[model samples]
Target: MKDTLLDLQDIQKSYDATPVLAGVSVTLSAGETLALTGESGSGKSTLLHLAGGLDQPDAGRVLLHGQDIGQMDDTARAEARRLHIGLIFQQFNLVPSLTVGSNIALQARLAGRHDAAFCTTLGHRLGLSDLTTRYPEQLSGGQQQRVAIARALAPKPALILADEPTGNLDEDTGDAVLSLLLDLVSETGAGLLMVTHSPRLAGRLSRRIHLSRGALAAA
Candidate 1:
């Protein structure tokens, strides 16, 4: 049997006295592409944060490869994230000082898994080959986003968590990025859980999961 890459059970979170997510349960296996959608403040991002070990659940279990990550200390959790999870954010959080090429290979290098051939090929596929010499500020929003995607994927993690990764791009650019991302996930056999507001994009995924008032429903 294939091992589950990520699992969240009865996840609950609150900001002060107000609740954001309640009783959320989700699971992702290898090579599966799952899209998450909901209206504003629907707890989609909260769920991603929890799943990625970026935030602890107020109540629930977070497991990565059958191990309870919520039980780990902050440093151990960070190590787990470094080794097994690739995170993508809506902001296109590339380092401003690094060239596109450096940004793409940086995390993998930190994880002691940098492969120049892989990063170079990813640059080619994401259409950032020419932009590799440029800095993040030198590229347009779409190009910057491609750099972010390359950076997230270079390490080849078991789980890829993207939080509105295409939110900054226009329709055409977003389509291109989504295609590259889907193809990469397929090629790498990594489980993808992407958070997005666009139904069109979500429809492109293999499965769609919606969050409402802290719970998830198949849509």
Candidate 2:
């Protein structure tokens, strides 16, 4: 059996008494790819945030590699995220002052796992090798999204949390990028939890789940 990389037990979250996720429980094993499908405000991103240790759940446990991240201190949680989780946000979230290569190396450097050769390979595969000296603003939406993917994968993290990773790209580009992402994840035996509204995209993952009104349902 594969080792469980992420486990969310009865996760509950609220903002100003407005519940975002209620009694949500999910498990992701190593080498699995799970797609999260939901309407707007269905709490998909919120759940990903909790799983990545970016936010604390109001109730229940958020465990990564069997360790309860919710019980960790702020610094510890941050360290956990830096070391084990790679996040690809819809907004690209690149540092404006940094070049593409620098931004891609940020997370790996923070985790003390920087691998120049691996990063170079990722850059080449992502079609970003030539753009390393360019800044985020200089690239198109698709290029920026590719940069985000490269950055997230540079660390070879055990888990990847992607929020609409290809939302800004054209269909062909999105599909190509997702294929590359899946191939890399499989190669590294990492678990993936991706949020996407497209059924076509969701079908590509090994498992699929839907969220509505802050609860989970079978896809």
Candidate 3:
């Protein structure tokens, strides 16, 4: 049987009395890629935040590898995020002061799992080896996003949460970057939960769920 990597059970969230996610539930397994899609106000990003331990659900449980992350203390939650989860954002949040190599190795180093050889391999695979010493400002949008992907995969985390990872690029660049992200995720055998507005992009994943009316529906 496939190992369950993340489980969201009846998740509920609110922002200052406005409900965002209402009793939404989902599960992702190891090496699986799941696309999350919805309208602008449908709570897709809220669900992703909850899943990544960046925010807590007002009700229900978030289990990572069968452990209830919601029950963990703040420090524990941060540790859990660092050690078991990798996040890629639409903005490509690479550190401006760090070189490509440092940016890629940052999370792994924080998680105490830095592997020099593996990081080198990732750089080569991402077509970033030649640019490792370059800063984020020196690269184009596509190259920057590639660095973000390399950083996320460096830790070999159990799950990867990507929110509109290709949103900043042109269509062709976005497609190519998305394909590379998927291939790298598959190579690492980590579960992927991606939020995207494009159905074309969503269709590339193994499975997809749509959020609407603050709840989940089949895509």
Global Cα RMSD, each model = 1.4, 1.1, 1.7
1-219 per-residue lDDT for model 3 (tens digits): 889999999999999999998999999999999999999999998899889888889999999999999888899999999999999876788899999999999999999999999999889876789999999999998899879988988999989999998886788867877777787668878899999999999999999999997998866
Order the candidate numbers by TM-score, best to worst: 2, 1, 3
Candidate 1 deviant stretches above 4 angstroms: none
Q: Across residues 81-165, which tens digit of lDDT does each residue of candidate 2 receive?
A: 9999999988788999999999999889988999999999888888899999999999998899999999899899999999999
TM-score for candidate 2, residues paired by index: 0.97
Between which residue pairs do clashes occur in model 2? none
lDDT of 2: 0.93
Ten-residue stretch with the least lDDT total in model 3: 176-185
Kindly indicate the candidate among 2 and 3 with the higher TM-score: 2
Against the hidden reference, what TM-scores do the models get? 0.94, 0.97, 0.92
Better of 1 and 3 by lDDT: 3
Q: lDDT-based ranking, best first? A: 2, 3, 1
Q: Between candidates 2 and 3, which one is better according to lDDT?
A: 2
Runs in model 3 lying further than 4 Å from the true structure: none
